[model samples]
Target: MEPRFLLLSDVAAELNVSDSQVYHMVRSGELPAIKIGGRGQWRVERARLEEYIAAKYAETAAWVAKNPLVDREDEA
Candidate 1:
């Protein structure tokens, strides 16, 4: 069965970033995570991670809307 929650390292591995960077993102609230268990380990819900990625795409689209690219040929 697939797991619904991922460990910090698992999230980092999936995102292709260092574990510390993932930790920083979670600390800054850019990503959501929960610290549970007797060791206070962090767990990131898969659904929330998907939401965060979709939000980033929406944000990038909004940015592009405000800064349209111009064709270089028109500058001649």
Candidate 2:
């Protein structure tokens, strides 16, 4: 498969997040990226992005499961 690359604006639109957020992710090494000249570029493999999202979702789910409300009825 051809490697797909997206500009900061396009990535922000697709993620429904601000451009800065994507930039931060790249800066913090949370998201994979490549540097081209003076610009930091992000090139995400579609499968890798999907895996990251899935891992994040699972982490959130695990946290919720571990921190269940004290009052079970109140949770309902």
Candidate 3:
């Protein structure tokens, strides 16, 4: 690992969300971040970003599993 870190804009672009959403995530503690200075600059660790993406995927999978479509058929 190269100790990668992402700026707020990069994270917002990666997540396809607004900058404010990223700010909210940081404030709400949904996403881990660090302040660089007194200018409210925030950075997210690459590892943490990956973890959050994985967790979101898992959550979506669980939701889909619990709410299967009525017309869907199991191929097995």
On TM-score, the candidate that comes out on top is: 1
How do the residues 1-76 of candidate 2 rate in per-residue lDDT, one tens digit apiece?
A: 5446666666677789998998888779777666665554566555555666788799999999999759978778
Q: Which stretches of candidate 1 lie over 4 Å from their true place?
A: none
In angstroms, the error of model 3 at 31 is: 0.6
**Best candidate, lDDT:** 1
lDDT of 3 by residue, 1-76 (tens): 5559999888999999999999899989999999988886899998899999999999999999999877545643
Alpha-carbon shift of residue 32 in model 3 (angstroms) = 0.7
Instruction: In model 1, state the lDDT of residue 62.
Output: 100
Q: Distance from true position, residue 33, model 2, in Å?
A: 1.8
Ranking by TM-score: 1, 3, 2
Greater lDDT among 1 and 3 belongs to: 1
lDDT of 3: 0.91
Q: Any runs in candidate 2 off by more than 4 Å, and if so which?
A: 1-3, 37-40, 69-76
Candidate 3 steric clashes: 0
What TM-score should be assigned to candidate 2? 0.67
Two-way lDDT contest, 2 vs 3, winner: 3
Q: What lDDT score is found at residue 74 in candidate 1?
A: 88
lDDT of 3 at 55: 97
